[model samples]
Target chain A: MTHATLALLTLAACAPAERGRTLVIAAYTTPREVLSEQLLPAFREDWRRRHGEEVRFETSYQGSGSQSRAVAAGLEADVVWLSLEPDVERLVGAGLVTGDWRGTPTGGLASSSVAVIGVREGNPLQLHSWADLEREGVEVLTPNVRTSGGAMWGVMAIAGAADRRGADPLRALGATLARVRVMDKGARESMLSFEKGVGDAIITYENEVVVARRAGVPLDYAVPAQTIRIENPAAVVDAYADRHGTRDLAEALVAFLGEAPQQEVMGRYGLRPVREGVDCPDLPALSEVFTVRDLGGWEAVQGRIFADGALYDQALSLSRGQR
Target chain B: MSVRWGLAGWAITAGVALWVGALVALPLAAVGAEALHRGPGPALAAVLHPDALRALALSASLATWVAAVNTVGGLAVAWALVRWDFPGRRLLAAAVDLPFAVPTLVVGVLFVALLGPNTTLGRALEAAGLRVVYAWPGMAVALCFVTLPFVVRAVEPVLAELDPAEQEAARTLGATRWQVWSRVVIPPLIPPLVAGGGQSLARALGEFGAMAVVSGNVPRETLVASVYVLGEVEAGQVGDAAAVSLVLLALAAAAQLAGRRAGRWLGAA
Candidate 1:
């Protein structure tokens, strides 16, 4: 068994030497289903018709931050679909995606979502707003910010709502986090923990609840009065694409994702369309919505909100007990 | 007898040296470079960071607990397997090795699945004010599950080699159960037990897969050093990751050396 595993790993090590007619995609975990089940097939079918040959697809899914790091560490992915703009920014900073990648469709956003609170059947605790999560004796589930893009979104939603209400954002986040019984590694894990009857509530993506309900889970969710609009970016990694000569194929795949028909599939799968006029029936109209730009873009918020000794860090410490 | 080195011996020595250099020395030096490249000040600050300290403390306590439990439990199980003539003796002996065979990640999933809040036993435990999953108990249990075989595998052979006649002689001398255990049985067992316990401690300290799943990983509460390093890497803090890892690597080396030295001392005594 050990020898077999070593042989397989050796094979994998050498396999990257030959880059065949394959569009290698590195993506965050949540979009795995949509990309594999619907989008990739459609793209492959279209590619075969256009190029008169089958274009094989190779995909790897991981947490957004991890995916970005992997690509930066020379994962040789022709394209990267990540959960946030900051991740794409990291690639650009690493000089991996050198093109004016943000000049693409929907200002570089391929899919969108809104922050939400997923609750158990019947909404027994009556959770409606971010403040509701801080109520005494309510167990909440959220992912860890360091490992999960979704967790960052969840924290921003909580802190943003608290800021909007003139409350101390750090205190509010700390209070809500104190009530969190389980902080899973990612948004999907947090939702899974909620589904397993772990917590009274979970702060997650609207698309998460949508996907869950579609999978026949009796999960219910609420779009808070104030929430952060989620944006997921897709870009071609110029270096890898140029190396593999798959720049066109990779670019086409990125473009194919934002087209109206593909946007419809993403909608049914719970992602809001970055493009106009695409409806996701599962997503309710949130009364008030904001974006990362509104919260002072990713740059302004990074150090002030998430860096060491910042609001989020202090809140995390406060969740356990004050220093 | 003095043996002279041949070409084959030289090739073998070179092969082993290359393996150690490439696999162990290279990564260690790389981590050290990443950690200390900014000078000792930032590296020290990173390790001494409040969150990093908390994670270190949590991992230490969890490893201590796992080592103690596995040592005692493993001894009992090994004793039973060596001494008893039971129907399922062979099956039980084989089952003890299963924990080693199963992936640590699967061990974590097993604990979470069984003790989930929705389960009846889990609800009862919660009602009793003892939440397991996402709590310290869950973390300890997960670590224990993964580190179970360490002590058992280490002690079993040494235990099997003990002479039955000596134990019987102590009994014949009218020594009480405790007397026989302490005076006749325990001295020989001490070396293996300490060796096994130390091995368990070292393994538990670095356990990531199971603890990552079972522990809620809330900062300053459930986060352990290994998981904290992963978190740092994900957050794009490679320097912080390397610094935390350097600290852990030093501690693990200290622990393994201590265990081996102590085991040798005990055996000699």
Candidate 2:
């Protein structure tokens, strides 16, 4: 029995390499379900037809910030599809990604969305714009900016809306944050809290709301007139790809994500297509949209707002006293 | 012994040493080395940072409350299970260990489902001006659930093994039930209770998954040391995370040592 067990273990270990190549994609948790269910099957079929062999995938999904750090700490991911640019930049800082990845195929953007208010069905609170979040007794749910890349974008979107309205951005953000009932560790968890009736509304990615709606969750989300456009970047981790001799496969997968067919699948999964002509009807139209660059890019935004003891910390301290 | 026997003995010793070194010593050494990578001053500064200090205080206070409650509650449970013969007694004893079988994250989810803002009980509690979820009390509740098995399991066997004749003798000597319990029964239970309380406290101090889901991770409010370490790591501050982790490890070590020493001293007395 022992000898037979040893033989089986050795065979199982050696089976994968003998079958075909394996690609490891580490992604943030929000897009994982759609990727596994919709995107990966299509990618696998196309890759097999092109290469005349089967290609298996190993996927790791985590909060965007944590996932980025895991890859940076040698998670051996061939491709990283994360929610924000800074997360990808961490790979650059770790020497895992070479060259200017943001200027790669399709400008390194795989999909796009915007921050929106996810409210209860029928919109009982009458929450329409960012200003409605600051009204008295209207509790909000958002993830912690320190742990969730999406939360940082939500804060930036709120600050941008405040700026567009000629309001004091710090005061506006402070008031809204004051009304936050709970800050979950990630965007998905915050949405779960909202679904559990923990808050009146949630500030989350537009795709999150769309995906929930498609899943038949009783949720109604409103796209504010002024909001921050959320762009999710995809890149091949050059160090891991070269080490595993899967560079061509990794690059092909990322490029395939930008292709029209895959873009349409992404749109169907509630992500806005990077290509202009493809439209997802579930996505609400936006009147005014701002990118990270409008707030002087991620570097400036992180420094001014989300950094330790910066605006976010100060605002939280001030609001803690009020509560 | 022959050379072959000596070689086998040496091989066995080497295996044991390797197991201990890899599983226990290596991880502790790695954390200490990384924490002190930037020198002791910076590591100490990171640990002593205001938010970290607050988190430490909150974790310690919550763990203390959890330990206190578990000590009293676990004793009552063990006493009833051992000293009584009632309907569902076996089932009640088995239910005490439910927290051990359930995953900590699932426990957090269950707490949310039961007491979240949307539930009927939750709404009633909120109307009564008491919030459970997303507050410090929610974290304490999660910790209590995860650490419930520690004290009960520790004391149950000792209680079972305790002689009923000692109590009967005290009662025959004209002692009341309260006096018999306080004089004869309580003294012998102290050592195990203290040890169990220490283990429960340690578990609570290091708890992350359940508390992470329930505590809201608010800075200087609901955030605990473990979650704070995670937030630091997420922010790409590995050095800070390592330093804070070492602080928690040190605290757990100190607490366990103090608890064991106190238990031994009390037992001797």
Candidate 3:
């Protein structure tokens, strides 16, 4: 027999007889990694308390929107704790999630604010506001909105600048965008690119910059005058759990987000509490500090301002000309 | 008893076939059906969007350049390692596999360290009026780094197996060194080169880790197709992403087929 046949048989035979378990997770950045790492032990402990069985989590964490798309395409994720509301709204539109997915918890995961441009120590160029991005010789590095969920938030911050600038921040923004040296597909790369000196500044999620600083990357964040509030939502994958006979465990896992876990785990990840009375770091609040709303959503925004090819072409032309 | 065993064998085969049909092939079949049936409404809209097209073009162009350059580089390296026994020759021979052993992501980070703006080399390049860390040149460099192994490995064995008598005969016929290499040494290398070039092209086309780290996935600039597909996938646009992926797969497959055909032609020649 061929190697393919033997491998198939081996995989099939290796299946556990008692019951199998898997958690379909959709999260972004290192916090997602932390969840898969530090919190799994605790979550499984909670699972065994209610279900009397061992469990496993099959997680996919990248940008929030990507995770939402996976679920829409029949990935059958049990919990989708993604970075933004629109991602959950995607599931809502597809009928996989309820419109009230946000209503599940007041400030559970959706309570995090959008990121600001973080620069290396000493504030080189004295970057004070979003307007600084327009300055010549100022290199801005942000994640590609096409691949990064937080990148949409970054676009919203810039579009807000356009609105604040009153007619044609695109020109100003375009000039500033010309300075963008790197456009990573993910938030972490955006940070790493900046730290690696690919750019003078980067616009990313606040949690991401914080995580970078925590990881000893030597960076500081600058909140723009305007920014978007990033809401992350969670849900259970019904089909996969039922198939794996881990329904009791799945239900317990989702239901466990009631309050204590929010203050304990999600809060530490820089996500504000959905419900009141949950303690966290004394960071600026998304509500009090920023004029927040979706940056015209994906359907509205993609073709107009942030279409992938158009942006790249313009950037490419600019870079080539300079070279 | 033989008939019974045959029936059981057929049953097992059918079972495994059905399982594969349900899981892997079924989803792909769905994508194929969707791609073929779905109009330019979403997919075409995405493709026509300058960013998607640019990514496609950039990825294609990079793959092409990588294949061409690596063909010459691979043959030279392989010929030297196999034909010549210079000092530290064994070390150099093993070094060809270094690209293979290093993760693409790590290679990207390495390049970022070596050529990023912060680095002395990168700073010097920038001062000299060039940007290599986050531009198309950056993408090309990263792709070349990842795809170096394909041509070298492919040609190495072929060169090793080559009969020395043929080259001696060519030299004996009063052919000069360059002429003997051109007429005798290169002919047999063509088939393997074509085969290796095809492999390199396929890899360079799909390569994500290195390109993602370096190119910054700038639309129309550095956004390669794989990165674009990833962007689509991330944005919860599976149909659109799948559509992009289908196009990419078709292109890669076509390139592979072209490579094989070229190999056959070279072999015949």
Candidate 4:
């Protein structure tokens, strides 16, 4: 009888502790390190304190478009913090996210950033404006707009600034692109090339510049007077969370990211807060800021700028002809 | 009497066929179906776009150069390894196959570290008005690095089996070294060289990871066909991506077939 009792105890002890939920976050590559290193640990601690249960996390990081497709093709992600709105909208279209995700967070935004130019330690080109990128002998490093959400935003920022200044946006964009010495697949890869000193200047996110500086890379960034605001949205994947019985936890996690403390964490990591009155000294101020909505939103931008034989294609062909 | 499979044999054959059909044949069929699903017009348009055409042209040209360079260099290295005794010859032989073992992406990173703008060599090249990292030369170098082993491995075995007695006879007959090599050594090496060169060409055609880092993917300049396909897929143009991919597959298959045919012809001769 004692042997039987001990066997039962051993079996019970060997079995897994009560089933804990694993929240899978599909995110773009740039923020993945920070999410794993800072955000996730804090969230796990907070969740443990509140629910009296342990939680685990799995992260999938890739270029935003690739991550979007993975989720659309049924990767079963509980949350998606992608680089652009189109990626989330893709999930919504595929019925993976049934809720109004955009309306849930503040301004439908979790974090924000703006495009800036990262120059070598000493700015040899004296680059201060978008026009400087088109100057002779000023090789620019940027990513392909087709593959990178951040690159798309950088392109838009250049064209929008040109349009606001009463120049032909296509021509201005063409001239700037003509100066691009190397076009990487994503913002992070472009930054890698920049770190390798591939180009004289690289148009990338302000947050990336901050991160590089913190890593002790000798670099400086310039925020032009006019730049586009890059808004990164986070949302609970309604279908997956509901199916996995993690809907409540996913919702709580997204909400926690918007709270002041987490927002400050984001700011320290180089993202601007979606909420107002949160001071992020590292983030530079811009006199004129535009959003995707200003360029007829994602749908229109996709059709007009990125569609087959669209402005971008035409400009690229022209640049090639010039070369 | 006809030899026939029993029930179990038939079942096993059917199972193997089913597995291969599902894994290999299915995806290829899907690509063809997707490419032509929208009809010939869109497929042709996608393939004929200036950017796609440029990529195709650049990849083909680069692959040809890489194949030629590897054929010559691979022959020299294989001969040196097989025909002579030298210090570090074993190490050199092993290092020739390093490209095959290391990941192509790591090969790209290695090239960048060695010749990026931050390095002294890269800066010197830059100052001399030669751009290596994000230029045609860089793409060629990357293709060469990844495909180096194909030709050397193919030719080394063939060279080893060649009789040294033939060369000795030619030398005793008062033939010069060049004449002996040109008449005897060149003929047998031709078959393997063609085979290896074709394999290298096929590989360079589909290369993506290394060129993605080394070539800078400029649309009209450095972008290769594989990168263009990736760009299409990332842009959510699945049909276009499929179309471009089919073209590449056809090119690779053609090259492989040609290689095999040439090898057979040479072997028979």
Which residue segments of model 4 deviate by more than 4 Å? A1-19, B1-27, B171-179, B266-269
| A1-323: candidate 1 lDDT, tens digit per residue | 99999999999866754533888999877887788999999998998788776777889987787788889998999999988988888889998899998887678888999889999877888999999998888988888877788888888888888888899998999889889877777777777788888888889888888888888888788888999999999999999999989898989998899899999999888899999887777567768898888889998889789887899988877877631
lDDT of 3 by residue, A189-252 (tens): 6776677767788887777776677678887777776655665556554555566565566556
Worst 10 residues of 3 chain A by lDDT: A286-295
Model 3: share of true interface contacts reproduced: 0.88
Q: For all the models shown, what interface RMSD does each have? A: 1.5, 1.6, 2.9, 1.4
Residue pairs with backbone overlap in model 1: none
- Tens-place lDDT digits, model 1, residues B44-157: 999999989999998988898888999899999999999888999999988988878988988888898888788888899999989898889988988887888878888888
> On residues A17-69, what C-alpha lDDT tens digit does candidate 2 reach at each position?
78789999998768866789888888889888988768899999877898898
Q: List the residue pairs that clash in candidate 4.
A: none
Give all candidates' CA lDDT scores: 0.86, 0.87, 0.72, 0.87
Note the DockQ of each predicted structure: 0.65, 0.60, 0.46, 0.72
Which candidate leads the pack in DockQ?
4
Candidate 3 or 4, higher DockQ? 4
Model 3 RMSD to the real structure? 6.7
Q: Report the CA-based lDDT of candidate 3 relative to the real structure.
A: 0.72
Docking class of 3: acceptable
Encode model 3's per-residue lDDT on B114-184: one tens digit a residue: 88888889999999978886777877888888888888898888888889998899889899999988888
Model 2 segments more than 4 A misplaced = A1-20, A48-53, B1-22, B117-120, B123-129, B157-181
Candidate 3 runs further than 4 Å off: A1-26, A30-60, A73-79, A102-110, A195-197, A231-281, A284-323, B1-34, B39-46, B97-130, B153-178, B242-269
Candidate 4 docking DockQ = 0.72
